[model samples]
Target: MKKLNESLEVERIYTVLEERIEQELEERIELGCWMYCKEFCIMYS
Candidate 1:
């Protein structure tokens, strides 16, 4: 079903992001709004 496929896709993206964050992020720190803002600034500026 379409709904089931959508659910699976969301799960897949979540898993990929979780693994990437675990592997690629700097020393374990909480993912807060400030961190996202800093990353956004770094990428755009």
Candidate 2:
């Protein structure tokens, strides 16, 4: 029973960490895309 509780807590912590990583990746991808677009516009003009 104690082991099960500990495992549950670990799983919850991992879930939160995974969510944060995904959010950060999404933000980085968006920033990268925006920068690429700006660069393209500058080159085109």
Cα deviation in Å at residue 24, candidate 2? 0.2
Best by lDDT: 2
Stretches of candidate 1 off by over 4 Å are 26-45
Give one digit per residue, the lDDT tens place, for model 2 in 1-45.
999999999999999999999999999999999999999999999
| Tens-digit lDDT track of model 1 for 1-45 | 999999999999999999988876644455566798899999999
lDDT for 11 in candidate 1 is 100
Task: Report the C-alpha displacement of residue 20, candidate 2, in angstroms.
Answer: 0.1
RMSD of each: 10.7, 0.5
Against the hidden reference, what TM-scores do the models get?
0.53, 0.94
Clashes found in each candidate (C-alpha, N, C closer than 3 A): 0, 0
lDDT of model 1 at residue 5? 100
Quality of model 2 by C-alpha lDDT: 1.00
lDDT of each: 0.84, 1.00
Instruction: Quote the positional error of residue 2 for candidate 2 in Å.
Output: 0.7
